[model samples]
Target chain A: MKIGFDAMGGDHAPVETVKGAVDALSLIEGEIVLFGDELKINKELSQYKYDQKRISVVGTTEVIENDDKPVKAIKRKSDSSMVVGMKALRKREVDAFVSAGNTGALLAGSLLKVGRIKGISRPALCTIYPTMSGASVLVDAGANAECKSRNLLEFAYMGSLYAERVIGINNPKVALVNIGAEETKGTPLYIETYQMLKETDLNFVGNVEGRDVPSGKVDVIVADGFTGNIILKLTEGVSLSIVKELKNQIVKNSIGKIAGLLLKRNLGDFKKQLDYSEYGGAPLLGVNGLVVKAHGSSNAKAFMNAIKYAYIGVESNLVAEITEKIKTMPAFEAPVENEEENE
Target chain B: MKIGFDAMGGDHAPVETVKGAVDALSLIEGEIVLFGDELKINKELSQYKYDQKRISVVGTTEVIENDDKPVKAIKRKSDSSMVVGMKALRKREVDAFVSAGNTGALLAGSLLKVGRIKGISRPALCTIYPTMSGASVLVDAGANAECKSRNLLEFAYMGSLYAERVIGINNPKVALVNIGAEETKGTPLYIETYQMLKETDLNFVGNVEGRDVPSGKVDVIVADGFTGNIILKLTEGVSLSIVKELKNQIVKNSIGKIAGLLLKRNLGDFKKQLDYSEYGGAPLLGVNGLVVKAHGSSNAKAFMNAIKYAYIGVESNLVAEITEKIKTMPAFEAPVENEEENE
Candidate 1:
């Protein structure tokens, strides 16, 4: 299988993307098709030693900047790496597409270019949240800020599948993210979502609060994009701040500085466990094809981990599984209609 | 001024409450009216040395258990410490009420017993988010999970007041918490709220993403309770997990073990900053009377800090200020009504 890599994306762009693609070739058996300006891609590729046959560069002139609006940029910049890589994925020229560029752009391209799976109204951006027990997958992390009950229902199933097939959690415990563990918490949207989520055949674990997310008691936590985005980013912000605090604390006194020297390796390991990059980038699930959105500030190692995700997504047939799962799952009875009919 | 202490509330009951009241006596001139089983409160208070005249006990027959439904429990248990404390505050027997028990019960009593300020639809729960620069006040942290645009505007002004009057940030920079920094980021509620918030005489800093809260870029971040609650608790979860992770990392090996000993002091200082107890309790703002909800797991020190918050809230006349501020501010332009009138 061939993987299309958006080499001209993310903060490090061509350099890290090229190096990451080369790193992935060492692990998996897939040809890497780099989509970017050929000169820049070749310049970065020259430094790495790899079989020239395993990697190929596709030249694209336009580059989507980080600040560009998602829908506008994707529609305007036809030759951009993100847009071009998506085209390759659409035509089935590549098995999957991966980009670490503008998250908004990648999400838009997934819907506009690669398109949504038939019958799925919205494609969710999954975020891999690191927890004490292991990892929890949060869906619609920033895709739809506002969601209907059906959207949440779809996310629950999609997230559960990804957790089971890709992450290898058997019978993954699914929970709705709410203010309280009780069914009564959250707004009207959550209340409706909770009622429907519990009725599903999935291993429903009821409600899990924000505090429960990092605790990792539940395997998957589904939330609307607005709430999910806040949770995802707040977790990142808190982790970053804590790491910063730890580094500052380590150098305070002579004794503390000496102690930091001894604990450096363990500290690094702890940081790795907390880091999102270790899980690779989150795949934009519920779409017609596999598309991974890596962190915009991704380094080579982060990008490589994201590339590995492409391998997992393809091998697990996550999209097809979700599509099939969608058909078998009981449909969400519209709350308004159901209530009206009952009355 | 006098403060009513719910001596039977929280995980640590009369023991912690009595101890915290004793601790507060040295700093403040107010009398502490303890509400609980008189015998139990007196027995706990006997251990601590303080002015007998400064502290008094008001016996109550019932206690609100943590698991009880908030609104029902408050209505049924008039003899409970939380309800009795609110009653005392309503009658001007105490300037403020502080509790560490069931959060919902305290919030319910705050509305049902003490009541909301004139014109405030729903009282907000203000959580003091500790950021790198300083502390930022997040209003409606877990109060109204579903909010209209007007509710958010009320929270923004209330948060700004609390930040300025209590937290001591002069003309605090206020920002709306959204999925994105753009004004068009969140749902229709946020967009309308954003337009009105800009028109107010607040130190309006525009939209702040989730990361900005911990980064301490803005002094007040106002969000509908659904988003705010998730942000508040997620921060707690992340901090708790990081603290747990750090403890594990500190004892990995002999070298690390020794490093942990030397670095203990710095870690303690860092932990103190992240500790919710350090800031005392979160204030239930927008109510007619001052009510502070201490953490359920609060110890003596945490209870004392919460009591300290009570003193600050009363001294600043926070509720009165919010009431006055609400009246002077221009009303939120009803989008549909305005459009219809224009046509």
Candidate 2:
């Protein structure tokens, strides 16, 4: 099996990306293709000695920056590392594709190049958030904002499968992220989605509120992209702000600094718990091929983790399983109103 | 001025709420009607002695629990303290109403008893969030889900007015909460709201993302009720989790415990900065009368703060000012062709 890595992606591109590829290749038995400028890749690779047979370099002339628009950038920069890597996945040259580049570009390329599964209307982004209990998967973080009830049900299905297969949970609890836990609480879409999820084969846990997201109340939390994005970002901002304030307070005085030193070991554990790098990349579910979106600022460790996640995605045949399952299942049909004599 | 307090509301009920009211009455020149069972209020109030005439008791037999359905509980339990307090506000017996009861009940009662402003389609609950640079207001935190663009515009207008009048910020920056900062980033309603806000008299900052909510990027952040509620709850949950985890870590080991003791003062300052009690209660904007909804788990400090906020709301004539402003302003009209129509 082979996994394609966009070696030119992320803040620490080529160097950290190459190092991460080497680290991943050493641990996993897979042929790895690092797609980027050949000179840059070789220059970074020169400092390390590894199993050369396990690694290969694919040359790409263009690069996509963080600020570039997704679709426009993907179209104009055809030879970009992310696009080349995705193309490799589409042709079955690689088992999975991973990029820590422009998320919009990666998502756009995943849909346009790799394409969506036959039964899926729109692909959803599934992010694994580290909670107090464990990690939970939030689907459609920013993929499809204006989603129908059927789309939400699909997100639940895909998220549940990913959590159970990749995250190693059995019968993972699936929940709709609503304003409140009550059945009647949320918008029309949430109420309808709640009813739809109840009939699904997955372990539907009913509605879970925003506060429950960080508490690890459920394994898979699904919502429309708009609400999901807000939840994900709000959690991130609040966590970061708290940590920032705590650090500021910890270093304020001699005694406080001493307190910080005494609690350094535990603080390190807390930091690790809050770190997204510990979890790999967010998967763009419902795509025809496995596509993983690593963080934009990902370092060597994060990239290595993303590669490992890609390997797992391939081993589990996640894309094939999702596609087959969706195809066989009854297509989500919008409720029809029978008009008897109105005509 | 008179302020009605639901003494039986909140986690601590009559004890904390009554203490808070007494504290406020001592500090400020205002008559507080403690609306609840007279015996319970008197029992809690016996601990404090100021002037007996400054504090009065109103009788109520029913109590609304946290788990009860808000509208049903409010409708059926007419003799509940919450209802009785709101009735006082409706009858002009009190200048403002304050409650830490079921948030939905407060909102419902506020709407039913006081009614909406002449042109206001819906009332929004605005919560003041503590940020790195003090506080910012988030409107429509859960009052009205599935709002049209016009409703969002009103949220922006009302939120801006509240921030300006109550928070004392001149020309407070108002931003529409969205997934991205770009004009076309969120749902069509957000895009339309952005356009409407730009044309308004307020200091309309462009789109603000969820991460910006806690950063104090803008003075006022507005969104439809569902998204706003998720953002508000997610922020609360994340902050709570971090604090809980930090406390656990601090007390985990002998040396850490010693360190925690040494740094307790600084930690208290940090905790106070993040605490919601400092900000008081969220106001139900667009209602005919001033109403503040305190946190359900509020302590004496929080209740006192809510009383102060209600005083400010009343002093500023927040409801009257907003009601008159909306009357003359051109009402928000839906775009002839929504952005989604072209897409």
Candidate 3:
């Protein structure tokens, strides 16, 4: 199987991306197709020794900066690494695609180029956040900002499948993110979504409040893209702020600094657990092909992990499973019809 | 000025509530009217000694438990401590009302009894969250599930006034919370809210992402109730989880325990900074009368701090200021018209 990589994406592009590709090629039995400016890719590749036959480069002329408008960047910078990588996935030249470039651009290109699954109205970006118990998957993090109840139910189905297949959780509990845990406690969409999810065959855990997300109470927490994005970013901010405060306290005085040294070993492990880059990448679910979005600040280790996760996505046939489920599942009744009938 | 306290509210009711009232009465020069079962309140109040003139009791026949539905609980349990305290606020017998009871019930009671300020579409529960730089206010935490752009502008107006007058932040920076910091990154409602906020006379900071809330980058972050509640509770969960994880790490081994002991002083300071209860209570803004909602798990210190905040709200004339501003400010133009005109 062949996997396409955006070699010029992320903070440590080309060099770290190349190193990661080399490492993945050695460990996994797959062909690596690197997409970027040929000169930069070759320069980074020269330092690494690996099976040359397993690694190949596709030349691209431009890079999408983080500040560029997602749709505009994807359209104008057609020869950019992200577009090139996604085009390969669309053309079936590669089985999967991975990029740490502009997140919005990756999401936009995946939908516009690689396209969504046949029956899915909206695609979701699912990210695994570390919790004390393990990790929890939050879907629609920043994908479809405004969603109906049917869209949220689809997110649940996709998220539950991803958690079970990729994250290795059996009968993963799915919960709708709401202000309160009661069925009638959220917006009309959430209340309606709660009803729909309860009717699904998945392990629907009813409504879960925002406080329950970080506690790792459920395996999958689904929401509209707007609230899901807020939860994801807020969790990241709180974790970073706490860690920063902890570090500040640890080195404040002589005794504290001494304590810091004594606890340095444990601190490293804790930091790793909080690190998003360690999770490899987030999957753009409901898409027709496997597309992984690595953190924009990813280093070589994170890039390597993203490749590993991409391999797992392809090997586990996540996209096919999601597509099949969407096809076989009961069609969503028209929202207006359902509302009128309920009344 | 007299302040009404729901003596039967919260997890540590009667005991902690009475202790907090005693503390407040001793420190602040205000009359405290404890509202609850006369016998139970007096039994707990007997533990503290203060001027008899400073403390009094108002009898209530019922109590509202945490699980009761807000509207139903308020309607059926008219003589409950929360309802009795709100009644005092409504009758002008007290300057403000403070409760650590069911948040929904307090919010419902505040709106149903005290009424909304003229031209205010919805009252918001605004909370001052402790952050690295200082505290930032989040409006419409869970009061109104669905809010329009007009409601959001009013929230911004009230929140700004509260921050400036009560929190003493001059020219407070107000932000509209969105999935991203860009002007066009959120739903149509956020985009419309952004335009409305930009036209306002307040110190509008434009759009802020969810992560910026905890960073204390802006003085006030305004959003529709759903997103605001999610951000608020997610922050709480993430903060608690991190602290819990830190404590777990600190107590894992004998060496770690020794290290924790060595750093105990600094850790204590850190914990205090992260503690939400230290910030006192969240105010139910836009109400005609002052109302503060304390955390349900509040201890004596938290309850006292909330009472102190209520006194500050009354002294600052926050309600009067906000009401006057709303009356004088131009009526909100319907956003649908503005969007069409702009297009």
lDDT of 2 at B273: 92
Residue lDDT tens for model 2, B185-301: 888888888888888888898988877789997999998999988888888888888888888887888987998898898899998898888877998998788888998899999
For model 1, residues B171-208, the per-residue Cα lDDT tens digits are 89999998888888888888999999888899998998
DockQ of each: 0.75, 0.70, 0.71
Cα lDDT of model 1 by residue, A124-211, tens digit: 8887888987988999898888799888888999999999998889999999999888898989998999898878898998998887
Count clashing residue pairs per candidate: 0, 0, 0
C-alpha TM-scores of all predictions: 0.94, 0.93, 0.95
Winning model by DockQ:
1
Clashing pairs in 3: none
Q: Where is model 1 more than 4 Å wrong at Cα?
A: A332-343, B332-343
Write candidate 2's Cα lDDT for A283-333 as tens digits: 899888999988878888898898888888888989988977775445544
What iRMS does model 2 reach? 1.1
